[model samples]
Target: MRVAVAEDGALFRQGLVLLLEAAGHEVVACEAGGDPLVAQLSTIPADVALLDIRMPPEPDGGLVTAERLRDAHPDMGLLFLSHYAESHYLMRILEIGTDRIGYRLKEKVGSVDVLSDTLTRIADGEIVIEPELAKRLVERPRSEKRDLVASLSERERDVLKLMAEGRSNNGIASTLFVSAKAVEKHVANIFDKLGLHADTSAHHRRVQAVLTYLRSQRGDA
Candidate 1:
């Protein structure tokens, strides 16, 4: 796949270019900030661009840049690269409203094969979310709880917290030291309380619950 990378650090930019090339993918452009990327975006035949959350002038300039680029190049897939797991950044990125996108920690780029596969998946119109964001969702403080989460009872809230963490019924049961049957009941109750019954898709309910949880934390929902 053809790729473009936008990162502020010179070493990291070159390293990413090299890594993509070594993995048998083309690196069309490796820019330091959003302006250069916008200048080159239309002309370059790149499939996806990996943007860092912090770049040029301010810390979250890239988020705005991604929004602009998404409007200009809706077909182009975008991936956000972050230094640490910040759920607020993920929530803000989602607000820009683009699909075929992803948010992952810089630490996730450890393996060449994984990076190559991730780029391929994103370019193929997939939403590749990082697991860290899931954990970050549930780890949010109680003072941050909003209407959606505030409505849930304590046990149901515990289930929702683990659910946002991507824990399975069995996994949550083990964590809570409850029976799997009890965990199943909790999961159903969670879906009911969150009003997530509309979708029959395999992961729709889970995704909705988690996004709601995170958006509540960001105070956007």
Candidate 2:
């Protein structure tokens, strides 16, 4: 797939370009700053654009670039790459309502195959959320005396615990000795129990929920 990567770090940007190129994907454009990225994307259209959540000039400049691109070229897939998987940052991108969006952690960039597959999936109209984000979604509280997991069955809770540990649906299935479809169903149920509507953008809420859970756990200690 043809991709354009916009990151503030020079070394990281170059590293991404090299990784993508090595994986037999085209890196049409790599920019270290948001201005150059915006200007470049104005002329060079790509199948996917991977942007950092925080870029120079403004901490949220990359998000601005993403919004602009979504407004101008709705067909192009946008992916947010970040060091910290803050739920609010992911939510802001989903509010744009563009399909084929992705949110991945920067640490996962070590695997070119996974990155390539995620880019392809995002371009092909899949949400392509990271497992970490999915875990956060499972921990949120939806109602009085009911955390997100309260509505889940025993099987669903097991799936959610695995998800929090960064297991994919297939991985969860393998561990539970069930089919992938069962894992998917459990995930869907978890989403429903959490009151995460059909907005196609729940990454931020997931992060927030996880943060809240972690803080509470620490406080209890």
Candidate 3:
């Protein structure tokens, strides 16, 4: 596969290039920042674009570039590499409505096979989420429900899981085989029961829920 990498850190960028090239994929272009990458995009049609979530000029410049690239080439696969898997970042990528999107943590980059598999999956039009993220997505709401799960309806707990997974109301409906309106009511109930309705971004809510969940799991262990 033809790939392009956009990352501001020289060492990390070079290490990625080495990894991808050694794995037998062509590294068509590598850029230090997003602007050069945007310029390079005009000349090169990449099969998959690997981008760092944080880049120069802005913290989310890579996300901005990904959005632009998606607009210009809707079919192109895009993968975001980050040190931390922020819920807001995942939410923004999903908002783009592209099936060929992936979110991976940098620590996992040590495994060439994993990285290659992720790239191939994205290229094949599958959404590839890291296992840790997936675990967090499932566990987040269960933790929040510890004090209230007994009182809350089963549907409310389901809604909370889907929300932590960064699903929209429509997504939760489809997944749960319920109507969007029903999902909406469940989400509202969840917020009310959990007291998570005020003074927090959706990003913060999801992160907090996931962290709480993970901590609980550790305590259980």
Worst 10-residue lDDT window, candidate 1: 139-148
* Model 1 C-alpha lDDT per residue in residues 1-221, reported as the tens digit of each score: 88888899888888788888889888888889987887888788778889988996376868877887888888888888888767677777767753567778877876798687678767866566676666556555346464555677788777776666445576679888999999888777767765667565545556666676567666677
lDDT by residue for model 2 (67-154), tens: 8888888899988898988656655665664367877898886787888878876786656566676566555534442554576788
Using TM-score as the measure, name the better of candidate 1 and candidate 3: 1
For candidate 3, the C-alpha RMSD (Å) to the true structure equals 8.8
TM-scores for every predicted model:
0.73, 0.73, 0.66
Which stretch of 10 consecutive residues in model 2 shows the poorest summed lDDT?
Answer: 212-221
Better of 1 and 2 by TM-score: 2
* TM-score winner: 2
Rate residue 150 of model 2 by lDDT.
74
Q: Give candidate 3 misplaced runs (Cα > 4 Å).
A: 142-221
Q: What Cα-based lDDT does every candidate model obtain?
A: 0.74, 0.72, 0.74
By summed lDDT, the worst window of 10 consecutive residues in model 3 runs over: 212-221
After superposition, candidate 1 runs with Cα above 4 Å error: 139-190, 199-209
Expressed as tens digits, the lDDT of each residue in 95-154 for candidate 3 is 664378888898786667978878886897666666667546554534545666556677
Where does candidate 1 clash, by residue pair?
Answer: none
